[model samples]
Target: MKAVASDSAIVLVVDDSPESLGMLNIALNNAGLMVLVALNGAQALSIIERITPDVVLLDGIMPEMDGFDTCRAIKQKLPNIPVIFMTGLTDSEYVIKGFEVGGVDYVTKPIVPDEVLARIRVHTQNAKLTQSAQAALDYAGQYVFCVSNDGALEWATPHVHELVDSLNGDAPCAWEQIQQLLAPWLAQGDQSQPLELTNFEPPLQAYFAGEHGSNHLLVRLVTPKKTKTAEALQQELPLTKREAQVLYWVSFGKTNWEVAQILDMSPRTVNKHLEQVFKKMGVDNRTAAAAISIRILESDEEAVG
Candidate 1:
């Protein structure tokens, strides 16, 4: 196999031990890979927020936020980035736990430089191939995207913006909305089934895509021939046409300012409509309004079906 270009790939190594970090850093740097080192999981997360690495070398045991927790956090953000665990314990339970927490592969303690490099190469190459395929899909305007268990958009096709806008009434699909929708499933832990939200304008569906770098849930924004019109919602829900429109956007977690821009109204006007929606729905908060709006939309779908 061809070696990756030193400048092409970045690797993050997180370990509490100075010796392990130093050794892995030198080995990876020598293998023509850019290396970033963190003394602990917190430091690793801070660095990851700024830079996306191709692969992560994580120490399984540390004083705080151990390897499993670190890997979980990483998967939440970068669901496609490969994580390899480095641990001294080789018990089956420990290994299983590693995989459970999103480790792609593991390297035993007293690491062999050559073995580590080989494993990194394999995972990194695989990641590149998957990303290349995803890029092709994106260019072809495919709606497939990978979201983390936390509902964070890890990667999506460029065409996704249009679907998101359609779902959110011309507003970009915000992370907060996605996370709110996924909160229920994520709370169920490992038994969480594939989640689907068909309450939007275009109606979206999500399935648990196979775990690769992380446990990524594949979300597909379904585009139907005809979407639920605001008039249809007004008749079913106790809301006026304008209030219904506001509810539609609210369902996708759109803010009053964003709804205002979408509806070509002032922010104050949007707020007034939302307040009316609250009164009509007997909901005090936006979250309740969104939840009620989703149930109404889902019921409408069932009726039509």
Candidate 2:
């Protein structure tokens, strides 16, 4: 039995029998989780309404409101929380009803400690993953503004408008705004290539490119900033503002099409940006570009006092 963390997950264990409840508490506690016991559906509902648990271990057979009804009530209140049914009754009807009521899985009792632990781990891991992914998506959806190495302004995703009022102070620039903002950040030595800005926001770095034969060149931005000091302490890389936009998607492992979707640009436009990124980073391929960009971004973080 592993000792659960103090901040370990809170588990709701609902069973009518004290013997069953005791057995579950031992297993859950050994696995390093905090257990809340309920002998009946009404007690379980009261706990759930006040404070949600990470996972619910529900017994299918109970007096008054049974596990099926309990599971339904839990789901209605906290849809994201997972429920695992524990029951001596292994009938197909009961099992199916468990799922219909939003039970994630069913475990036949007498409960094996290993089986209980495994089920708990599975649901907890899933809950954690879902939470992390949602947080990442939410951050990505927010407006972000970056200053190019060359002191030009570049923008991406329409959401960014909220962060910086001006795309170009003189006028309202559209998607084609990349060309105007990043001219100064282009590499001087390599006319065709661009400078890579290794530091931007703590954890986020950028790379910029010069004017290609077309009206615009692709941009890339990468940030791993966890704190304000972390973002501020890193030394700035030479990337232009335009290249920073392209780099942002590259770091997220987005394909050209996905990047296009986020930026509301055509796939062709995204591909064009990639070409500029490859040239600017002096990497012949996307893999090399991604590797170098990550390295530069990670290594540039400053030690915070």
Model 1 bad stretches (over 4 Å): 1-6, 141-305
Give each model a TM-score: 0.45, 0.47
Candidate 1: worst-modelled 10 consecutive residues by lDDT: 296-305
**Candidate 1 lDDT over residue span 1-305, tens digit each:** 12233445789999999998888888888878889899999999999888788899999999879989999999999888899999999998989999999899999999999999999889988987787566547544556666666767667666666556555664444445656876676557653454666666445555444442344556554433345656666887788888999889888889989989998999999899989988988889889988877776665342111
Pick by TM-score: which candidate is best?
2
Q: Which stretches of candidate 2 lie over 4 Å from their true place?
A: 1-6, 138-140, 143-305
Model 1, residue 55: displacement in angstroms?
0.4
RMSD to the hidden true structure, all candidates: 16.5, 22.2
lDDT for each residue of candidate 2 in 1-305, tens digit (9 for 90 to 100): 12223457889899999998998899889888889999999999898877668889999988889999988888887887899999898889999999999999889989998998899889987986675455335435543333344435433433444322343342344323443434554535333443333322222233543332122233444433442221221234335555566666676688989988987889888888778777766889878877766665555443210
lDDT score, candidate 2? 0.66
Candidate 2: clashing residue pairs, number:
28
Clashes (N, CA, C under 3 Å) per candidate: 1, 28
Candidate 1 residue-wise lDDT at 286: 89
Worst window of 10 by summed lDDT in candidate 2? 227-236
Report the C-alpha displacement of residue 97, candidate 2, in angstroms: 0.9
